[model samples]
Target: MPSYLEFFAGGGMVRAGLGGRWKCQFANDFDPLKVQVYADNWGEKEILEDDIHKVEAEDLGRRADLAWASFPCQDLSTAGNGLGLGQANGGDRTRSGTFWAFIDLMKELKATGRLPRIVVLENVVGLLTINGGEEFKAVVAALDRLGMRAGAVVVDARHFVPQSRQRVFIIAVSKTAKIADALVRDEPHPTWHPDPLVRAVHKLSGKCREQWMWLNLGAAPELKKTLNKIVKSNPVGVDWHPPAETKRLVGMMSDENRKKLAEAKSSGKRVVGTLSLRMRPSNGRTIQRTEVCFRGLAGCLRTPKGGGSRPRVIVVKGASVRTRLLAPAEAAALMGLKSKYRLPDVYEHAFKVIGDGVAVPVVSFLRGKLLTPLLRSIKKSRAADDSKARRVARGSSERKRRGQLELRV
Candidate 1:
């Protein structure tokens, strides 16, 4: 089996998806919290928790059969002001520079002629639009310089889970191996075209205006799951009861905010947050509590760093729908994490991990279609090389025998 080294190994999701078929040799990531979670699950493997730039080439070992990197996307992400091509500002170039650091590591291994046989990189779909797609071009050019054939696929999390997350994955292989050109995007298939650009965006025409066109692109694919599947069937009983003050605020969303919701249209009914407000006699302070809906699909899960509050819902079916923000268990289920997956962190950190992870079934599909084929190509190349070596040896023996017979005559 081909061996692999996974970098930026967040919670070991990629490894978990691929490890059933491939052998994982080494893995590394910088986040201590995520490392702890990863180690909790895959403690038997070598886990490196250090700055990736400092990792020695030899540490990756002489024969890295495959390399995986789900590189940091903050630089190119819409979350980061779209500072993709130029020097990333905010005095925090650390994450942006990490991609270069990865390239440097690859160069070091190349010196020993045992660089990874294949490389896979994952990032947010925003990378395609960053700098008008120059960022994607730069990545492809880098792999070309390293003599690796590369292709990219844009996958939506809704394919596996209810959440709508779209991530871009780039798969590359060394030039020494020759895979069917069809596997690359250059060759289009009948059912599914490998060309990502063809499927990148969906264009629509306005109903009233014949001349108007709309580009509704980067939107997540729709899944058959509804909010009911995501929520707990047997909630047992309501917990985290909202105080009276919290209930009042939900009643007080401004006319303007409510109008925005009315303007936004969705096929399924919409849900909105409600508030209950109260004054604290002890501290002479006012507090607001949030109520959510249990009948609709959830909004995106977010990291809870004081700013990343999960969206609340209070109204459903155009009426006052009373509910609470999803409990930790519900959020985990929405993200497709196994119920038994140990989450040792506080609710805040646990939310962050789930928010950052790839949907389990989405990764599994990618492994089967994109990764497994590349690995098989490597094996086929090795076998062809062995057969050619044998043929050459046999030809040499025959030439020697014919020469000896001529000399005997």
Candidate 2:
């Protein structure tokens, strides 16, 4: 079975996606709450609930087939201040600087001849343009220094689930490994390679460019679930807003958003959508407004910090419009987690874990389309090379024996 080392394993969503086919050699995360949740579901056999910087190569058993890191994205997310992975501004103390520690671990693994054959880094799409795309170049350059040929693809969770979470997946293969031609293309595909990512690739240094690849995962699958399908009519861990409070929420909507709500109410049939309060500029002043999405998709789930960041659900059936804080169970459903998956009892803790995770189905899609196939080809190539070496060794021994017999004669 293929093995993996998971870094920043929030609730082990990556492991869940990898399923039973892949063996987890090691997993690490710093957050205590997330660690508890991960242990509750996956046990504590391979988990080390500590900082990634303090983790040593010895902590990881054998070299795994793959190393996956979904490092902290606060520094590179649009919701953040765009600090550019700490090399330029904050100097390794920033949240996203955790990526450097991951790189350091990779370096140690390489020095010990335990480097994995494949490495995958998952993060927000802002990594492509943060600090004028310098951070993205630095990441690719780091992989190149480790003797890895790297490529990146932008995958949106909306393709697999109702949430509109877009994440960039950087996939790197060891220079010594043989990659099948079918797994890559000489040029980027329009769907997976957005303009920002293409520009970021073009801006890479010559050495990094030479080592870069255009990974070909082909087209995204059609979305299976819609917003209405995943949301529960009666959700747990939260109560629906009272009629007066729901009216106040509607009163907070701007002209455009109120029109959306009005249209939904007039549809006669039931309409379900997502709502979030955002501050927008109006006549040189910023004002908070409740925006609603009537489409079949939900807004991207975010770690609820303050009141504004939390997303709410809006249901309209004829003239009855109700609003409520999106339930924790509903958020998990949006993330494509099964109903039986264990979550924290606290509402905020459960939402934080769900919001901060990679969508399960998206990881599963990549495993099916790219990871498994690529690993299989590499294993086949290595087996062939080993067989050839044994044959050569046997032939040499036979020739040596014949020479000894001639000498005796």
Candidate 3:
């Protein structure tokens, strides 16, 4: 089995996507809550619950086939302060600087001839435009300097799951590896990158562009899954919003949203459920806004701070109208995490874990189409070399035996 390393490994979401074939050689994360959840599921033996900068790559005991970093998105996301890479804004900026530390480790490993064959990084799509897209280009250039063909694509979870999360996946392959192009040179990939990522990649400098890799996984133009399909229709014993709370949610709606709710009520349908709620400035006053989705999809999952960012599922069944936070299991389903995956005890922390994770099916798609095939090719080449070595050994042994016979005669 190919061994791997995961840095900033929150809740082991990457492992869930990579499946059981790849062994996690090392896991590192600083958050105790996330570490606990990861240990509960993947076990504590391999995980190192400490600051990643403090852990040396040499301490891993063996070279990993791959290394993945789903680094802290807090400094890179728009929902965040957006200090972004290479800025000096105190510890938050220093925290995002951890990416450079990861790069440093990659450099150290490469120097020691222990560099992983593949490296993958996941983060919010905001990284693409941060610092006028210089940060993204610098990252690709950094990987290129290490003699790896780096490629990036923005994948939306809505394509594989109910949530509308668009994250950026940057994959780097060793220069020695041979792999097929994901994106066609002259042709456009309408499904994979309708616009943004392809555009950004085109803008790469000639040298960096030369080191870019592409893999065509044949993603669909869109997905058929729905939010209602994954969410619970009848959640018993959970806190359902009372009439007073439900009235507040309804009264907060704008005229257009109110009309939509009225229309849904008059349509003779017994049930209608809305996915999200937002607080926006209306006429200079902060007002709550909830737009019931007609599209059968939920808004992106976010860490529900006091700002009311966590989405609510407002259910209007028959004469009863109710609202409740999307259940933790529901959030897991939205991220394509399996039913059996263990979540944190506190729902708030659980939401943070789930919200920041990569969608499982998205990772699975890459694994099946890009990662698995690339690894297989490497293994096949190694196996051929080993067979040739064995044959050479056998021939030398036979010659030695013949020489002994001749001498005896």
Best of the candidates, lDDT: 2
Give each model a TM-score.
0.76, 0.96, 0.87
lDDT of 3: 0.77
**Better candidate number, 1 or 2, judged by lDDT:** 2
Error of 1 at 115 (Å): 2.2
Native-structure RMSD, model 1: 8.8
The C-alpha local distance difference test score for the whole of candidate 2 amounts to 0.90
Candidate scoring better on TM-score of 1 and 3? 3
Task: Summarize candidate 1's per-residue lDDT along 17-132 as a digit string, tens digits.
Answer: 77567888888988898889889888836788988978988888758778888888778887777766443223444475477678778878887897787787888877767666
Runs of candidate 1 exceeding 4 Å displacement: 85-94, 181-224, 233-249, 252-299, 311-320
**Residue 290 in model 1: lDDT:** 29
Model 2, 365-389: lDDT tens per residue? 8898889998998888999999999
How many steric overlaps does candidate 1 have?
Answer: 19
Q: For each of the candidates, give the backbone clash count.
A: 19, 0, 3
